[model samples]
Target: MVFLKTLAYITLVLPLVVYLILNKRNNNKPSRVIFYYLVYSIVHEILVYYLTNFTDNISDSNAIPLLYAIFTIIEFFFLGYYIYDSLKNKLFKKVLLLCSIIFLITALINLFFIISSGVNNQLIDTIPVSTSAILLIIFSILYLFEEIQAPKIGFIYSNPKFWIIVGIMIYFTGTFFFFLLFSDLSGKDQYNYWIINLICIILKNIFFTISFFLPLENENSNEFDSSFGINHYNTIK
Candidate 1:
């Protein structure tokens, strides 16, 4: 358990390190939404650990859940924006927007009405987490389909977005049921099974780091790809 926790922390930072190195080498896109998300993640984890263990003025019981409730919204926003930006299909874009607005409403209601109101007894609110997982999984798959049907690069996996989407796909798929079942699981079971989440986190971060190494040829809001060992896009006219 301790080792897995340590490993998870390491995995979370690895991508950030890779991103910074790539940037210095002029191997990264101008926009750094992924970098911002990585920083947000590390900060949230630290805050959770501190609030749960050290903070005394605040009620200990609600701290972590409250943090998660709020951070979960931002979490979805970043990943959703990434997918939305990567996609080009007009109908699909509209669907993504509508689903996002619906999710925002539902997640906000869950945060304010249930988690913060003290009307609910559960330590963690599963609704936001579960809903976000489902939406992200579906959208990730859609992005994958869009990429497959009209690929920009010679080899599909050469694209950085491919790695990013796969990371999101694998993480949400692996943890979807675990998070949905969180509220019902016994303390012992939760403790024993939490490693599954940790493993998925590690895998997601590993893939994210790989994506950073392969910079997108077009993070310029013009989605394109770079082949392996190449950093710039090649045009054949």
Candidate 2:
């Protein structure tokens, strides 16, 4: 399973790295948000891997705070970037607006509760992770909007894109549930913590595997189009 997990990482992230590097070289429309996210993932993966060696010490380790901080920042940036992209497209604008409104209301409520109390850092930590997971699902759905305009051009409902969306949704759901369940593991039963961790790891690996083959299939399609026709609208990323 450890080997599988490492393979999953390569599968999921290698394409992303390739995409970013290729786009940068080709002057294609590379997303800076994704770039930063890639960096965050890399750093977080390294830190968390090392920190795992000190399992008994995780609760008080600097790694915990650092990982939380990095993930929170990534979540905020992802939300902002996704919202912008959703609004930029006509088909997704309404959906994006609704999500934005809902998020803002929830955030205000969380803030109100925080201010009322003496500032509960634990609960505050939950907000961004929870909200980000929800927004990522919305973003996955909103991603299909581009397909409405040019069905043949980009990765809308195509095989790879479709599966990738499914993978992302699964990942987001899994991650959010883990956060909600384990945020206060100190008070939970040992079994609960172990179960959540086990389930989360399974889901993470599953999502990673799904994410891995996504790029190659899409790349293949683009290559097919290029060979057959020049005007094959090749902006599927």
Candidate 3:
């Protein structure tokens, strides 16, 4: 278990290191947001690791769940914005924004009122996490469909965002049920099931590494013409 956990940590950190080194030459908003997300994930994991090891009281150690709640909200915003920026359909973008707002509001409510009142916030609050997974899975499917519907570009496999979304889809879809059961799992069950999450994490990071290493393209390049081709649209402009 320790070896698996260590491997997971290595996988998580490797992508961030690769991205930082490769992005020095050129950087874009989406990639920068992804880098920030990766950093936050590493920090969150480290904090949880230390807190779990040093703390004795469950209430005092509720930092894991609290951090997860907060991180889920922020993660959804970053990923939603990335997806919105990647797609050209105005309706899809609006839907993504609306869902993100609703998710954030729901998460805030969970954090403030729904969870245990005091500093502990012991409740894992899987509602927001599961919702995020489901919504992201849906959006990822839509992204693939959109890609397929549009005229062919360079091999879809070669597109960096394609791999990133594929990673998201696989991770979120695989973990949806796990998040639903996380708060209820026994210690033994958790230990057993955690490998699943670790595997997904490794896969997600691998995809991220692939994305970072792919050749950079101008955000506004007219390489493909489609009403839904987000690569051609310059959101910054």
Candidate topping lDDT: 1
**For each candidate, what is the lDDT?**
0.81, 0.54, 0.79
Better of 1 and 2 by TM-score: 1
Better by lDDT, candidate 3 or 2: 3
TM for every model, in the order presented, reads 0.86, 0.54, 0.86
* lDDT per residue (tens digit) for residues 16-133 in model 1: 8988887854253322777788899999999988876788744535566777888889989999998988888998899999999999998888777655565434655778898999
Task: Give lDDT for model 2.
Answer: 0.54
Question: Best TM-score goes to which candidate?
Answer: 3
Per-residue alpha-carbon lDDT of model 3 for 23-90, expressed as tens digits?
A: 76328777787788889899888887777787788555456778788888888877777788888777
lDDT, model 2, position 55: 77
Candidates in descending lDDT order: 1, 3, 2
Residue 37 Cα positional deviation in candidate 3, in Å, after optimal superposition: 0.3
Mark the regions of model 2 whose C-alpha exceeds 4 Å error after superposition: 20-26, 51-58, 79-83, 90-125, 145-155, 158-167, 184-237
lDDT of 2 by residue, 1-237 (tens): 455556655644665655555553323222344445556666776777777674775544444554554555555556456345534476467666676667766665655554455423352256656776788777776675554544355444344345445555776676676666556657545334445444544554444334333343343344335533655455442
Candidate 1 similarity to native, TM-score = 0.86
Clashes within 3 Å, all models in order: 0, 0, 0
Q: What is the lDDT of residue 117 in candidate 2?
A: 55
